[model samples]
Target chain A: MIRQFGLPEALAILSGVQATILLSLIAFVGGGVVGLAVALMRTSERTWLQRCAGFYIDFFQGTPLLMQLFLVFYGLPVLGYKVNPWIAVAIGFTLHASAFLGEIWRGSIQAVPRGQTEAAYALGLSYASRMRNVVLPQAMRISVAPTVGFMVQLIKGTSLAAIIGFVELSRAAQIIASATYKPLLAYGCAAIVYFVLCFPLSRLSMRLEKRFAVKT
Target chain B: MTYQFDFSVLLPYWEQLLRGCWLTILLSAISISAGLTIGILTALAKRSRFTTARIAAGTYVEIIRNTPFLVQVFFIFFGLPALGISFQPWSAAILALSLNCGAFSAEVIRGGIDAIARGQYEAGTALGLKPLQIFRHIVLKPALRIIFPALSGQFVLTLLTTSIVSSISAEELTSIAQSIDTLTFRSFEIYIVATILYLTMSFGFATLFKLIDRVYFSYPVK
Candidate 1:
């Protein structure tokens, strides 16, 4: 039975906006925590730590997200862990986000002037205090714009979870389109919802970038 | 965990995997060339004197940038058929990729164009150059030099994006990996191999771009 592409169908697709947002949030927060450690490691004095962090970033950034998701989804089972699409996608996106965010923050950390670190050292501040009090605050300010910019990317990326049958916005659109045979309406509606969710963030990112550019 | 690993099962399908990589490279090549053309045109339109052309170009870029590429693919492949415009999976994949890349590269190209000072154009005109000659001699080369690094980076990104076209069942490496997974049930092994192949391709292209930048964009030191 072919259902009509009515308000009900549109709402069904729109319903998926929640899952998409939730997934993005989970990935962003989870990635942020791990990403901070990665960023610090990349900027550390230890050559081995820097090399390990560099490889981690390159491995994630160099491959397709689809393959990464597939690896976790399938690889987990081989290791004798039960897997579901949600768990797999969450893990995949978190790792991907960490690599990207880690790289961004590393750049920001380095962008802090050498004079600041020198002054902290001259004041007899320890390495931990120097980083926490002097370096990271400035780096955080530099990173805000790009971090918001990345949120836009992360939101759109969540759509890939639909491919693995996670029932997100894109998957919901697929379900409706296939059922109602109104691919145009189903996908178009989903696209609009995504735009609404993403456009403001894009604009805010650009605005923040401009503001920071002027200040710097 | 007593799971035994077997990668030898995929050895028999090496030819299929190779073929898939060839198709991916083909798709990316065609789309990048086509997209660059579209990008140049759109960038010009965005800078045009006419209000309509500027708005149209701006609107296209904004809409494409804001939405996901997968939905765009679905809309083109499946949705267009409703309007009596249908494409084969491969054609649809190329069209979507080109359109997506065009929007992104337009912004990058436009930034390059804007970086060129107005005095350069006036200088060309003072030298008795025609407008077309002015653009060719004074504008294009330097603009390309300025944008080549970002443009090549974007191209690498487009190459990776070709994998997403697999969702529409277009013939590519990722799609082939899925097929082999069902056949051998060695999902982990096959994906590992595919990921490594992708890593190699990206790194290779990045190195190649650096070489091209050195060859083409570096200015002669006096």
Candidate 2:
């Protein structure tokens, strides 16, 4: 028997917002940490480090996220590590996020005026202190808009975990849709929920971009 | 680790993989062209004098931009059927991809158009050009030149996104890899191959776009 598309069904799908948010948060924070290192590496003086970082960014950016998730989901087992969908999806998203964030930040870092770096060097600041005190703060300011923009992508991307059977919002909708035989209502509700979640961030990104564009 | 990596098992399925890649290219090509058309029209509509047209186009861009493509695909492929508007998987995939691409490229194209100086339009008017002629001669080319890199980048993204249509049972590389995985139980190997194929295709397209940029957009306009 097909279940009616009722409030209860809607609530069940809405419940998935938590997992989606959690996954996006985890990926963002994790990716941010690794991505910083990547950005630093890309901007570093060492050519080898830069090349390695470049290759990492290129590899991740060039391939599809689904394939990345599949690799982790399936490849982990062959290496004798027990894997669950959550672990696999988390790893995949983190790696994917790192590369993208890294590239974004690398540009921001380079965009910091060359004169500032020269002044930092002339002031006897160490490389670490120069970057920590002089460069990163400025780069962070320039990066806020794009980073937030990327957050919108990250949130939408969390929906892909559904394909790997991760029980996120999209998967939840799939369950409800299949059960209720009301695919239209189920998917439509899911789309609205996603819009509710994403539209604000998109606006904020654009606003931040405008604000920064004027100041810079 | 006792498991032996056996990529050899996938060797027999190379032809299927090739076919999958071809279909993916075909899907992306059709969607990109359709999307560019939709994008140009929507971008123009958004900038039109009529408030209704502007609002309608704005709303379409926002709705598509804010939602995930997968949900869009699901809505189009499965949900539409409930309303007696069913489509073949391939048709649904193309429609969803084009719509998604259209929304994104509309923004890009609008930005391009907006970047053209107001004087350029006035200059066209002073030259006795019709409005359509003004847009074609004065606005469109420069705007396209400015946005070409971004547009091509979006196209590459659309190419990558075609993989997601597999969920609706649209025949593509990811779907083919999934089928091969079922047949050979070599999920890792199959996916790795698929990933490499995707990487190559994206890189190839990026290179091709760069070449187009150099050949067509390189000339300095007087």
Candidate 3:
């Protein structure tokens, strides 16, 4: 018996929201940590470190996130390393997010006036102290808006986890769309759900950009 | 812990991969052109004096922007069939990609328009230029040069998003790589080569855009 597209199916698809949010959290939290290190590496004095970090950012930014996910989920198995779908998706999303966030943060770091770093060095402040004290505080101001902007992107990015059969929001919608024979209703709800999730963040980022511009 | 890296296995599938890459280029080129045209219109709409025009354009940009491109693709590819208007995968992919790209470019172009100073418009008006002619000659002419970098970046992004079209079985590079991987079980090697192909495409597109920016918008070296 063919079923009608109804509230029940919409709710069923909506149930996947938790999974979507969870995956975004995993990617953002993990990517933020790794990305900070990458940002530091990119801005480091050592030529080799900066070049390696540059290559990493360029590579990740240049390729599609879909390819990166496939590489982790399918490619790793060929190297005889078994990865669960969760691990694979997390790894893939983290790597992709890190490259972008790293670059964003690197730009923010560079925006901090060189004189501040020089002053810190004159005060016998080491790299960690200089970053922790002088540069990062100012860079944080420059970073907040773009960082929030990237987070909005990161949330939307988790949707591609569906490509790995991870049963996220987009995949869940696809399943219902096929089963209920109502792709319009199902995917329509899916798009609305994403809008609800992303629109506010974009607004907040814009607001933060204005606020930060005045302060900086 | 022994892993034998094999780039040679992919050599045999070069012709197939090349065909896929060509299709990717074709899809991106069509969408970028279509998307930019739509982008320019919507950008003007968003800036229109009519409230309704502003609202409609704003909503269109928001819906497309906030949603994931993958969902947008599936919605058009599968959802429209039920509405009694159906499309082949390629057409559906193109439509969704264009709409998505157009929405983002709308924002870029709107920013470009907003960046133009009020004085420029007044200067044209004082010189007896009509509203339309002032915009065409003074406002948009300068705005395009400023937004070229952002638009080109978006163009490269559209190229990458083309990879997602493979989900609809559009036979792009990623899709071809998928089938080849299954046939050879060289998943790692196949995807690595595919990744490099994509990287090269991105770099090539960026370079082409740089050249275009130079030729079309070259201001006397300031």
Candidate 4:
């Protein structure tokens, strides 16, 4: 079966590995920044501000990203604004990642000891100063493993973009599978590529867990 | 420049949409139950003393975790047919969703089981209980109690993910919405309604899980 398959066809499917990598990068960085803001808003003192953040997170996280992506990629045109599939995919994935990453980071931030915040307050530091100088610094340590862990989810989630007709690795594999009439080989290679992308992160997450455990 | 929002156009198809929702519900329920069993077994395998068992369990988890559910569905729906195992869209979708949920649930359960104190297991052994009895009565029951919340969380995640099966034409809520969109050209309204439906379903399931947890666990949570 292996010898029967042509190399060029497999290479065609493999080429889209770059798109998968790019999709993950955009979601990771974009979601990271937005997630930090949402996490801050979630912990804010203002009631409405906290509620707004809560709604934002719940709405995005509760519903499926597939629907969200369709609504963006398709719904936007109905609203008189049309963008390319890639932009819609990015927006959809970025919003989805932000909600999850926000919650994860919030847990990490809250996991920091209450004593640390009290100490910062006693030192006459402002709320902003406390978060910037003390709370965030400590939370970063607890956040490493989970954040890296989520990258695996974010990367895998990008495969949903294929539904809207964006040609990512999975989509490319679908195309090749159709052309070559070799669904198993094409998809097997695609799955292997995804594994290659995600396996290292899984190992890194475990290592971080151990490294962080020793300190705590 | 006024476009009046029209929903009456969708009225006639309400029953069809409802049927689709029911399918989605049934698909998710079956996947959740089946996935939970597979997850617990895999989690146990990963933690077993046998190296082959650990590797097999770990490989299943890593493959499922890394790949998208959409791709997995495609592989099963399209690829398996080549290997002479034919599956309808519904069965393939359920299989893929269950596999995906199994991986995540295994990790959550493994965490819960691993968090158990060694003293508890030691006490079970010292009580002259068989290893299998100790596992069933001592290890698993307590582990399920601790991990119930995480397990429910994964179930909700699985519900959200079932939308991907729509791509393979499983006729779930999202697929029904797609047809409605084609007919009425009200993409935003149709999707907005679908989005609300999804949110409501997810919240409803979460609440139901909470009630189940309360009734079954009966451990007053702080």
Docking model 1 quality class = high
| Cα-based TM-score, every candidate | 0.98, 0.98, 0.97, 0.94
Could you tell which candidate, 2 or 4, scores higher by DockQ?
2
Position B151, candidate 4: lDDT: 90
Candidate 2 whole-model C-alpha lDDT, 0 to 1: 0.94
lDDT by residue for model 1 over B1-222, one digit each (tens)? 888999999999999999988898899889999999999899999999999999999999989889999999999999999999999999999999999999999999999999999999989989999988887667777887899999998888888889999999999999999999999999999999999988988898889889988987888711
- The C-alpha stretches of model 2 lying farther than 4 A from their native spots are none
Q: Lowest-lDDT window of 10 residues in candidate 2 chain B?
A: B213-222
For model 4, give the TM-score of chain B.
Answer: 0.94
Q: Is candidate 1 or candidate 4 better by lDDT?
A: 1
- From the highest DockQ down, the ranking of the candidates is 1, 2, 3, 4
Q: Candidate 1: which stretches are off by over 4 Å?
A: none
lDDT of 4 by residue, A101-163 (tens): 999998999899999999999999999999999999999989999999999888888888888
- Comparing 1 and 2 by lDDT, which wins? 2
Best by TM-score: 2
The CAPRI-style docking tier of model 3 reads high
Off by over 4 Å in 4: A1-5, B1-3, B128-130, B220-222
In model 1, chain B matches the true chain B with a TM-score of 0.96
* Model 4, residue A70: C-alpha shift (Å): 1.0
